[model samples]
Target: MRATLIDDLPDEKLATAVADLVRPGGRWRKVDRGYTQAQQWIVRWPDGRSVFVKSGTDALTWGWLEAEIGVYAAVDAPWMPRLVASAGDGQGCGPVLVLEDLHEAQWPDPWEDTMVAAVVATLEEVHARTAPAGLPPLSDRRDVLHGWPLVARDPRPFLSTGLAGARWLERALPVLEAASARADLSGDALLHLDLRSDNICRHRGQVKLVDWTWACRGNPVFDTCAWLPSLHAEGGPRPERIAPGQPEFAAMLAGYFCSQAGLPPQQPGSQRRAVQRAQAAAALPWAARELGLPDPGDAPREGVPR
Candidate 1:
């Protein structure tokens, strides 16, 4: 029987394509998302060991998780998933990655203090590694964010017109550009641009970091900054209104600095505040634009905000 192609395949078709890769009798179950861009699956082997398979278009940005395989190949840690096998014909529409399953891992609520410490330590160690040249730098700063393509791939057909949606992308471009100019391009160390807790799992008394596509060489502080707001929220979920200079932000800064080189906490003063405000202003606009919704503020101007 001819194998099914991976391109543009809906869930059913993609499931068929994946079946060809796994052993017979291996049942496949789809994993829901709070994280990532690829379609995830849980495959149970005859021996009962489960593995995960991810599939998506071959776009460099969406295909970033493939980079995680390479990264895991380069780094040494007991906490990260071991890359099993990856197959992709860059020319064909079918690109797939198969990795060791982490179905047994579980993370406690409020995140254990040791777990948090371990995560910070891992980030510090990973960020210290030298990164390959020619790849984009991993920065959470404006420069890093701006350097990425403004248009992300949108599979959906419509756009949102809500206030939270309209002002998001429309107001964000300028802020991103301005932040990029002042961003630190120094110290090309390997960094995980996204370190949200959802990507972390606890297994066998160890913590594992998943999702590696956004990993790059850049300033570590920005990566630290990204984790602060989310990790400190109630139940580790982001809050609707996070006041500046709050204890939550302070704890994140303390965790980051103390976990690594012990630098004093960088207060989220004007500069960081500006970045936050700019980001908040941009979110709604981005959502609207992503859905292809009409923006009332789509006027052309010399110095609108960037």
Candidate 2:
């Protein structure tokens, strides 16, 4: 389904939806940051209660919002925000999720050593929790975990774009593919799949992992590995120091980002390619270091190659 934006909602319908979660006289103030794929607002009711409202209008985003709803209902983790209420019709109308407003919470600064360690420890706790059965398999998301193999088979994207260290990537494709194949990505632990600092926040001395749409059944360690690139890009420790003894996982991630980085820009938000580029550039160094290959010294800076 196509993704919908918050502006797509009619004023009357949006009011009705908000009323379901907050008092009738409540007002919604848009939150300026941390909303990538959805619209977010802080709803302040007349009774002095505040809640967070996240609504997605596009089909793709609607589906993810629905999945998040299900995950929230199923899990009782204190580290996650509380789902207050929700409204949606499975059709194209999209879904709105109302959650407890973590007013004093703050996204951790990846550059801070203490905050980084805290985030890592929180991830380990999340992984330690047993995942409920029947969650979507991480393997099912071919675009995320398995795209590297296809990219390895066809080096056009890496070579054609003149990506930094393209020759190294071409040479290491087989080894990366082998690492991808040998990586043990299966497990009973619930994986966040996407674990950047933006999705994690500290609220009243507890780490809360928000954004459950990407939650899946897979190796929890993959979450840690996935977060390394963002940490590195943000001036934190290198992936090697953050996650030692996991070259295969790093290689697979490198391949995944490398595969997507050279693709044409996606529509609506042309930032997808840029995000992939940054992640790929950040991850390649880790993968190369781990694989004993040449450094791919940050070729693509956060945007489409010119």
Compute each candidate's TM-score over C-alphas.
Answer: 0.58, 0.86
List model 1 lDDT by residue over 1-306, tens digit each. 011222232355455555555544466676654233466777776787777777774475345755665676676667568776565532243566677888667754567667767777777777676876555654344322443122212201111212222244345434433333444545687776666555777777777777776777776665665564446542432322222323222322322221222112234221333323333333323323333444424533232121
Q: How close is candidate 1 to the true structure, as a TM-score?
A: 0.58
Q: Which candidate is the best by TM-score?
A: 2
* C-alpha lDDT (0 to 100) for residue 137 of candidate 1: 55
Candidate 2: where are CA atoms >4 Å away? 1-10, 32-35, 88-92, 153-156, 159-163, 298-306
* lDDT of every predicted structure (CA atoms): 0.50, 0.73
TM-score of 2: 0.86
